[model samples]
Target: MSKISNFFKGGSSSSKSKHHRSRGTPSPQEAIHKLRETEEMLTKKQDYLEKRIEQELATAKKHGTKNKRAALAALKRKKRLEQQLTQIDGTLSTIEFQREALENSHTNTEVMKNMGYAAKAMKQVHENMDIDKIEDMMQDITEQQDVAQEISEAISRPFGETYDEDELMAELEELEQEALDEGMMSMGGLPSVPSGNLPSLRPGQRATTRRKVEEDDDMRMLASWGT
Candidate 1:
């Protein structure tokens, strides 16, 4: 045992005795054997309990249970025990797995190395056995998993991809053309003039306001009258 401890801890020969000491935690091989034993024990207990329940039900039906409520209570108790037995069966299965690994490791040094890893895993399991911590971890994992799933789902969609430069430029041109067309239509095919209600001329053309044109007409009439 000291040798095994020293093997793992890199401890010195003098400290080997303390290092190799077992905490009575079952080795993988031992755990597997115990799992088998537990499996058989739970199976037997379950069968017995089932038989007892059946007997009680039959007797109650035949003799007419004085109190239906009492019979119901007994039924619930049996169900609770059955559930516990089911949990035990599951635990036994895990033990069996440990046992098989232990057996494999005994023949293969690699497997044995992994067995120490399994022991560490078991230690972590024990440490996190608290309901609240376990629940919190589970919730955190669930939330992260959900977020990842959502992102995956979104990215898989056709719309998830970004438009390339060429595509963006083409779209921009189309929008600009549409706006220009709308502006032309709104202007009744002519460009918008200033608020003075005068004809807006091109850069080389002369601009004439209605008031200025009317004043020119008045000056012409006065010249004709003088002539």
Candidate 2:
């Protein structure tokens, strides 16, 4: 019975010694590793929160919400989620803002492309400008003006008669010739020709011959000798 009690006591003390030995102090490296692991976990949570906040901001900007209040209100019960994310910012009311650039870089490119397309579409329209119709209208107006001129010319002249260009020129030439002939006739009287005959002498002629005998002695001697 004594041996059994001693054996039971030794067993208890050994178990207590084993427990004490198992509770040995941790190394500095182990404590540092645990601290780093906790820090990494916290860093991961911060990163997740930051990404979520950025996503929310992007959504708000895309919809063009009026104000933060409106955006917060739009979150509804999700506001709790946002609060959880922003709560760790520690006493600072300021928020981080990163501007998002416009995604549509080529603004005028669309307008220019459409303009080119419209120009190509209108090519046929520009080519078919109804030039023949315009020309026909112009010809009609010219013909009407010519008819009006003809009517005016007819009214200015004698009625029921029309003169052609050649006929008018001929008539003018004839009138001019007639005026020249009339002018010449008024300048000089008519011309006459002489007849081929001589007139006979009378008593005045015989007296003239007798006065010729008294005119010269040569003439009277020639007359008595009769040669």
Candidate 3:
């Protein structure tokens, strides 16, 4: 009796130690994976139970009225399998809800962690920066841009153009008059020679004819002007 009691105490202590040394809690990702696997297993089991229920139902119908005992037994088995299928359905629903919750929580955790990391990096980047220096840099850039724009406008401006408009117009008119005079001297108020042939007239006769034509032209011009 003493040995048996000691053995029982030893077994209890060993079981307690085992329970205490159980595995740590799984991460969200692992938990979700485990839940999905369990769901799959339960789903397969549900399918098997459904198949068995159908088989039992068929057996019961086939044995109806001919073997009442066998039919009753088949029906009883089908009912039990149906109940098991129902239980599995409920379990699957619970596991699915839990998995979804865990997945959402994990996503939120990762997002928050990344956001915190980015914020830290940004803080570090600006840790040594001065707002006053930043403002001064911006102001200097604006001033340089203004100076550059002024220089560009100065370079593009027209130069060496201080002549008076009235004087330029008078000079232009004088030049035009000189050109007209040169043109008139070149013409010498002579009639154009005929391209086909010259007139076959005596020299003094031609000179006399020309003087008479000129007088007639002058008289016609005076008449037109008076009209």
Candidate 2 C-alpha lDDT tens digits along 1-227: 99999999999999999997997865544544554555456567767866776766666665555676756654543455567656644312221111111112233556788999999889968787788998999999999999999999978887675769898899999999999889878978566345656566799997897788677767778889995
Cα lDDT tens digits, model 3, 1-227, are 99999999999999987886785567898889999899999989988998999999999999999999999999999999989999999999999999999999999999999999999999999999999999999999999999999999999988986789999999999999999989878999677666897668999999999999999999999999999
Candidate 1 worst ten-residue window by lDDT = 202-211
Range of the 10 consecutive residues with the lowest summed lDDT in candidate 2: 94-103
RMSD of each: 26.4, 29.7, 8.8
lDDT per residue (tens digit) for residues 30-99 in model 1: 6656767876887787788678667666655644468777677666666776677677678767766776
Name the top lDDT candidate: 3
- TM-score-better candidate, 1 vs 3: 3
Against the hidden reference, what TM-scores do the models get? 0.31, 0.23, 0.69
Instruction: Estimate the TM-score for candidate 3.
Output: 0.69
lDDT for model 3: 0.94
